[model samples]
Target: NRCEYCGDENGPFEIHHVRKLKDVSKGTEKWKQLMIQRKRKTLVLCKTCHTDLHRGTLPDNRFAA
Candidate 1:
């Protein structure tokens, strides 16, 4: 597989949620409402690519947060 963002080899890549789970899981019906309302996105990324995305060093991509 290839890193969805950079097109680099994605060996043992991980599925990453665009939005943080903690924020997604707020504490009430609002959370459920948000889940229902929003189109949650995820990415299949290699460890290095994943790290870069979080560190804000990589250009944004559709698959990345």
Candidate 2:
């Protein structure tokens, strides 16, 4: 499977979830916005992407991080 955020075809992936619309809106990151725009509650991220997301930094969608 590939990462939903970074398009990584590797393993060690993590699923990041946002349960609340308000909480999702509070985030301005591209990934977060994507989740909101698609009306999804989860994002499958590679290790690097997951780390970047927690650090408030993530690369653009469908890019290799």
Candidate 3:
């Protein structure tokens, strides 16, 4: 599969949650429900893109260019 961010199809890929799981508080049922609902909001990213995303340096047009 190709990376959703950079369209890289020849490297290791990882599922990246749009909303990081760790950022969601686990202290409430509502939060847990929201987390479950938000699970589908993910993107397949290549290792490089994933790293860039974490570093806040991923280009907005990474896949378009």
Candidate number of the best TM-score: 2
lDDT value, residue 28 of candidate 2 = 68
Top model by lDDT, which number?
A: 2
| Number of the candidate with higher TM-score, 2 or 3 | 2
lDDT of 2 by residue, 1-65 (tens): 77887677876899888777678887767887878887888888888888988887676654543
Query: What C-alpha lDDT, on a 0 to 100 scale, does residue 20 get in candidate 2?
Result: 78
Q: How good is model 3 by TM-score?
A: 0.59
Candidate 1 Cα outliers beyond 4 Å, as residue runs: 20-40, 60-65
Ranking by TM-score: 2, 3, 1
Residue 9 of model 3: what lDDT? 78
Over the stretch 2-53, how does candidate 3's per-residue lDDT look in tens digits?
8755667797998777465555445243323344555645667789977886
Looking at model 1, residue 57 earns an lDDT score of 61
Whole-structure CA lDDT of model 3: 0.62
TM per candidate comes to: 0.48, 0.79, 0.59
lDDT per residue, candidate 1, 5-46, as tens digits? 556673668666746545545534332233435545555677
Error of 3 at 59 (Å): 1.3
List where candidate 2 sits over 4 angstroms from the true fold: 61-65
